[model samples]
Target: MARKKIVFVIVEGPSDQDALELLLNKIFDRDRVFVHVTYGDITSRAGNTPANILKKVQAEVGKYAKNNHFEKSHFKEVIHIIDTDGTYVSEDRVIEDETVGKTIYSPDSITARDKQSIVERNLSKRKNVDKLQATPLIWGKIPYSVYYMSCNLDHVLYNKQNSSDEEKENDSFEFARKYKSDTDGFKRFISESDFSVGGDYQSSWEYIKEGKHSLERHTNLGLCFPDSER
Candidate 1:
């Protein structure tokens, strides 16, 4: 029998990997997809940034090719999913004068201009290296909060503020507990979501301000799915 084709997905952490694994499995045969966690943020000096992660991916592909005596073509796609973390601003920066509510500086607080600047800055810093250009890279702008009904997955899952990193790890499982049980419903939610005007961090912030879950709605995981599934 021919070996199954694999799709590689590099995520920020285990929670992200878990959440995507559930969705990917629904869209394709479980055996055909592989989701990996970078275990840290892109800004960190770890194997998580776009350039470093791609290196890891290439290494893995090489290993598989050597082990199985197969060609690198065995892999179909290499997708990178990362959170914008509110345009790389520190969450400690507090918004002091909001009368309606004590709003903090977050990705939701960033303007379109600032968001674009941040994206450009990050991209500029990316090392010039060859990547799997045919792959589809998805950005989860600001964070996964854009996906879970416009709320932070940590707060929604654990119902607490200032959650620990370990607590945050459970986000995917909690999301699956609610959303994955009804696969078709979840699929419809993803397919019909229209969260942003322009599908960028600034647009996501606008939708978030309107008390909408637009970010979660606009997240594009379609590349991981088959045409029929999408």
Candidate 2:
């Protein structure tokens, strides 16, 4: 019998994989779902550009394939899930404050100790995300797509704009338990909730990148499901 192909999902953290892995597995019941945790936002990583991001993703996929003795044909698609992080906001909107030790995300603005650095990171991230959205294939063999959770996965799921590590893990665990046996219910929440962006894939991307939408609660993940489910 032929093996089911892989739905390789790339995410930014273990919590992300944990929160959605079970539900994603249920959604793609006939195929395998493997979520790759990137640890940090790859789009904002140092030295990452539009062109090299492709190579970076390919490297991650290749590493997995080699480890599993899987060939390129084993993959059905590479779906990247990342935080929007208000990456498209204007430089003026990035505020600098000394009291805060780390970056803070809000629907209308981002605050950090270093405003210029935040602005620069946003600029770089915006470019890379735009590039990835335009690239339909990666490694010349895998169908690739990227989705956003603005200002991040935690926000979209837990409505927590910014959370401590302990808080994040707790929230993610609770969320997972909530829908562990209800994949269809999970699907509806993402597709029909107020936070769910109402549009096709490309249009959702377009909407998030506009104004402060990237920092708001919005997701286009419904498009990743099968057409029948959608």
Which predicted model would earn the best TM-score?
Answer: 2
Tens digits of per-residue lDDT for model 2, 68-152: 9999988999999989999988887889998998799988999999998998899899999999988889877789998889899
Assess every candidate by TM-score: 0.54, 0.97
Candidate 2: C-alpha lDDT: 0.89
TM-score of 1: 0.54
- Minimum summed lDDT over a 10-residue window in model 2 is located at 221-230
Report the Cα RMSD per candidate: 8.7, 1.3
Model 1 clashing-pair count? 4
